[model samples]
Target chain A: MSTLSLTTSIVDATGRMLAKYTPREKINWGRLGVISVPSVWLFVFFFVPFLVVFKISFAESEIAIPPYSDLMNWDAEDTFLSIKLSLANYIFLFEDALYLDAYWSSVKIAGVATIITLIVAFPMAYLIARSEPNKRNLLLMLVVVPFWTSFLLRIYAWMGFLNKNGLINQGLMAIGIIDEPLIMMQTDFAVYIGIVYAYLPLMILPLYTALEKMDMTLIEAASDLGATPTQSFIKITLPLAVPGIIAGCMLVFIPAVGEFVIPSLLGGSDTLMIGRVLWDEFFQNRDWPMAAAVATVMLVMLLLPIMLVSDGQDKKEEA
Target chain B: MKKTSKFLTSSSILGFLFLYAPIVSLIVYSFNSSKLVTIWGGWSIKWYGKLFENEQIIEAAMLSFKIAFITSCLAVILGTMAGFVLARMGRFKGKMILSGWISAPLVMPEVITGLSLLLLFVALENTFGWPAGRGTNTIIIAHTTFCLAYVAVIVQSRLSMLDETLEEAAMDLGAKPSSLFFLVTMPLIAPALVSGWLLSFTLSLDDLVIASFVSGPGSSTLPMVIYSKVRMGVTPEINALATLMILIVALGVVAAMVIMKRQHRLNKELKE
Candidate 1:
């Protein structure tokens, strides 16, 4: 009995030592550690940054130096004084019809672009998804390969195609399709083309994922029951694909609302977006507080919808 | 049936043409012997020569590469750790919030993300007296913060598909947990890690908005240089640079795909 007790104690001592030398033994501990790193990083770089911007939104706007200079005034004790924490910036947004107009224009453009992209990408996604498996891979590769290039380069390439003396205009004039060079660049139509070209892949990816996961057997069974092709599609395929549609729409719409590069490159000065406005305020006008206010508004609008969709998605996944 | 298939084929062709036409024009015009970007002269390598001679563009390109390499490496590490926990460990309190925050930047507006980071830097400088000023380091921090989401999502998805039994078997063999991770789990997820790293690298290299916000004077990235230059006047030398970039990226993708296919086939044969 004494030998048995001695052996048990020996094992316990070694196990304790081993546990001490190793990482946290509790699963919760390790998980928490893992969660904490990204959480802290996000809190510092993302969440806190936004909070800082929100603080700046309440600050007084002063520009003496060049753009990208100090945004706030600090006291001897390191307390911020410029952030007067007033309602002036928010109030300014309400009174400024131009800002409100830009926001509405951005929303309308994003909506129109999402619908157009859906129309274009849906057919392409459908074709790719319904094709033979071997061929589908190559086709999807073709779709994604363009995204490898710098996004701005793609927009630059569009300028070559859309300018008055550019390829499209040149081709049309040379072929007698038009009497004169067409003003394709710096137009809202050009903006539409630029955005649709850029974001079409975003739309296609989720749609393809949705279509790939769909059970063809169900569709066949529906058809075997004497239902029409469209009926089978509507009943079996559409419902299952709704998640992808939502995901795709959100992906496209959110970015389109904040798109500045496309608008600046392809559209006229009248092309108004919140992103462009924010950029002008920060970089051109040197109004950091006003820029922060614009950014805060965008963040608020996006956060609510994202949370709603994500919660809905989580519930669906759980079900 | 033939008629319908023909229609579908034509539409696909048209879509492909629409996508490829601009790219082809850009490439062709890169070699044009003309100063004007729109009008093409005889084929020549003059633009390519000019592209190499431009010191500003070359410097920006090098900066972009250096930043991309470091950010991708760091992002892949943290993302892998987070993904391992999310996939292997069961849920606890704040799991939902944790996941949400992980993916929030993936969909967040670039302007907001950039603006917010700028604000953070300004605030931090005033308070901590560290990070001295924004430059390469700040740009890297901002890039890593956002690109980590892509890496995490990719790793999490891959881990979900991985067989958990392998890790269990390793543990049962009395292998230490740390050794088990390095020896078993890492080897299994190495492909996902590679792809995630590549994705993050490309994203960092391509980013203009966030980089613009965080980058300081003389730390101008390739896209920034190109943007400022193009805004002044579009040039053929940029076309040459763009074409070269497209070529390099295409090669990378094709190589990755070939390797992945071979790996898949080998795995299949072993299973059989």
Candidate 2:
């Protein structure tokens, strides 16, 4: 019995020592599997596609199945690889006033909508942030409730409200406020309303989180030091909220520029956002290469803003 | 301070009015018994009754729910793994690229993502002769790619906020790593997983642009159908549909709020 006990204790000691010493050399199959699965999936499905897009952008459009020329060509007669790189699509984009105007108007519309969202969101966020703690959760939840509902439905709601003979016009007529139905649908105004309505929560949530985290006592102290409330707000609150504003604006503006739904549904035929143009070029015109070129250019244009957003996030994290 | 508060109060009220007026009006008009959608004839449930008979909508909704269900489940699995690596795995090779891949989808425009993904599928089919065509499967894949990002972000945050000691203690008690994850870690982060799932479902359900790009002629998603309908014009049936959707969302919100309150109370009691 003693010999058996002694052998068992020795085996246990060796086992513990082996576990301790060999851990580094051991291959963790489980961890490796966890890491590799997502990485491979994302690499194939997310990252490589952008490279494909970039490659396709430089190829010529053809009347074939996929409708774009292969970038690399090999000839059997000669042992040589030739790349058929064409910038014709990009050149076409620059030469075409439609593309230029679409880019310009998309930027303008997105920027204006972002500014409006900010104006509406700030007060709403501030109100929630400064409210009694007991009620803040409910208030914030209310803000998020609209977000949880159908985004399309929210936009569709406005479509009905702003229709020529819809609720707004009917109500106005009943109130003796106007002679004829106001034409609000199929206009930039409608697009702006849709954008602001859809993106308000995006703007507000970040602003609320930022504003709530702020030092309320700093504003109080500034006021105690004989500064007026407006002065305290400008000096203290506004500067601090700049990061939130940037984050919020980026959240709204980045997607807004490439927005397809708002422009198609709300804006008139003359509304020329690049997103719609790309959609049309692909589906309507069947110009795959040209569409790829448009998408590539749009991405390049957005790179600066995207870089700024990431850099801001890094700095915010450091702080 | 008083003046600012007053101004803020008024602006906030206006903002809430701005946020909710259109939706409330749409819901109200859904009940109107009228040929004209906007003009109220009387109160009737005809639209709701008619909505039940719409085969196209029913088919489209079934398709959307099926897609969302598959997408959410796939996303949670892949996303949980991704999030696990991000939160628990120390510095490793390709960490930067992996993280960038995960977060980039959050801000990337739907148009660009859709275009690139569709192009990818075409190229893949050309080469591998798989994913034979764009349809519900393609839509599921596209939605999963974007939805996984959300799940990863949520799960990562939840994991980070969790106390590490609980997990360490479980390990000390001779729990295998796999068992520890399922038994302890998962239960603690179940709320985040649930939120991620719900978020994925809603996002996949509401998606129009990406689904449009990936979906073929026969596989029309609910959003695509609704987009076509809304583009033509508003209908009372759409109003009824919108109202029904709003009701579901409202119910979900209430349930979430109740659960959150209960969680808060439990935490407070534990502290005592």
Candidate 3:
């Protein structure tokens, strides 16, 4: 009993000592450890890169190795630090019809492709989500399996299928559908096909997740109340799936806007994408500032739609 | 169960067909004995054999593998910390910036990302005189930036589902915070880390445009090699390469699924 009492007193003393240090104080240091490593790394790599791009966009292209004029000119003579900023790069993008057309075409193509994806993915996702429990996982897995395959290779697969002498044309010719090949590849049609095909999983998975978790009882109640299937779907299912729809559209649209691989591989030379334009400016034309300008503008173009989407979602939530 | 409508069922079938047909054709044509890609001569493994004999492809694959291995390791470590912050840390200063920087990479255009990273490297080289020339190092860093976000999202989702009471209990039992994390939290989130690592590995391997912007002479990745070749035109050898990559990825996906299912079952059993 004496030994037990001694141990209890020691334990009690330690407990008091532990209580002296609030968990918040201890967790603050822990928070710093967790936050600093990744945040600093992102700041240096992710955030700093954009800042560099922004800075470079303000500088002019030069013949020197870096191919861009320094924004801040430090003159060693007479204690001078001169900062030169130019809007010429941004102005040049406006002056060129090529840049304007590329930007517009990118938005149109991505927007249409996103709509197609929504039309294609919604029903398919619904099919999987509404399936028997045993088959639901398998169905969803099948949808995502192709996403794991190499993205370039999948786009390449479309190239093989859509080429002039490619499989589809060859098979069509063998059956004597037309004397001429359909001229499908190196066209906007092929670009659309590639984007839709490659990004299908992204569109489907989100819709499936949202649909699967939906309460079935609500649907049954709507039906019991003598609402038409279409009416019930419009009122209940459509509104409920709005979050998934928005998520899916953004996923499909964002990368599709600045696509290089699909457009370059399967698109005609005449088909202009901002990504290809940026590549040409930076690599082919060796104009780093112009490329930075193109990228900055493209980022703004991408963000506007996203902000609007989020804003609309916010208003809906408030309502 | 509600009967699936005919339209939905048919459309789903068509979707699967659209997704699988090209891949199936690619796989089937990989074995074509004829040099022509579309022509189906009797099936043979000559392209696969030829692929092995090519020195350029072999070296490129090795370099890609090395880069991917390094990228995944760095991404997982840094990403776990980011994920912990997102999931565990209450509101903090600069959380807005942190969240934006993290999620922005997920949907950001590859060209923009690639361009910005390349510029950052060039500026750093000019100012700090480090990363002297772009090569595998630059590619790995660029890849880790995006892959880190992917991992953080995965790990964050996993952690959101985690029970906090267990950590509280561990602390109450006199476990130090560091030990509590390593012992209690790490084990629970190990599966996410493994999957995140694998995803980062594949993403690094598959990247083309970003690697293109940052890569220097003699350090061409496999995708870079393939991109140049495929740009000229499709080749039987590329079909062979595509076939091999698909097979490997399919196996990996199946393995991941099995592991995740087993983990779920184990969790359920433990709860019971």
TM-score of each: 0.90, 0.93, 0.93
Per-candidate DockQ vs. reference: 0.42, 0.50, 0.50
lDDT of 1 by residue, A90-134 (tens): 899989997898898988988898888887777678788888868
Q: Distance (Å) between predicted and true CA of B121, model 2?
A: 0.5
| Deviating ranges (above 4 Å) for candidate 3 | A1-28, A174-179, A305-319
Best by lDDT: 3
lDDT of 1 by residue, B117-161 (tens): 987887788778768888999999999998887888778878787
The lDDT for every candidate, in the order shown, is 0.81, 0.87, 0.88
Interface RMSD of each: 7.4, 7.8, 8.0
lDDT of 3 at A273: 91
Looking at model 3 chain B, report the run of 10 residues with the lowest lDDT sum: B90-99
**Cα error of candidate 3 at position B87, Å:** 0.5
Docking class of 1: acceptable
Clashing pairs in 2: none
lDDT of 3 by residue, A1-319 (tens): 3234335546665676577557765545765777899999999999899889999999999999899998887789878999999999999899999999999999888889899999999999999889886688788778878988899999999888998888888888889987788999889999999889999999999898779888889999999999998999999999999878887888889989999999999999988899999999998999999999999999888876555444433233223
lDDT of predicted model 3: 0.88
Q: Is candidate 1 or candidate 2 better by lDDT?
A: 2
Q: What is the per-candidate TM-score for chain B?
A: 0.95, 0.95, 0.99
Put the candidates in lDDT order, highest first: 3, 2, 1
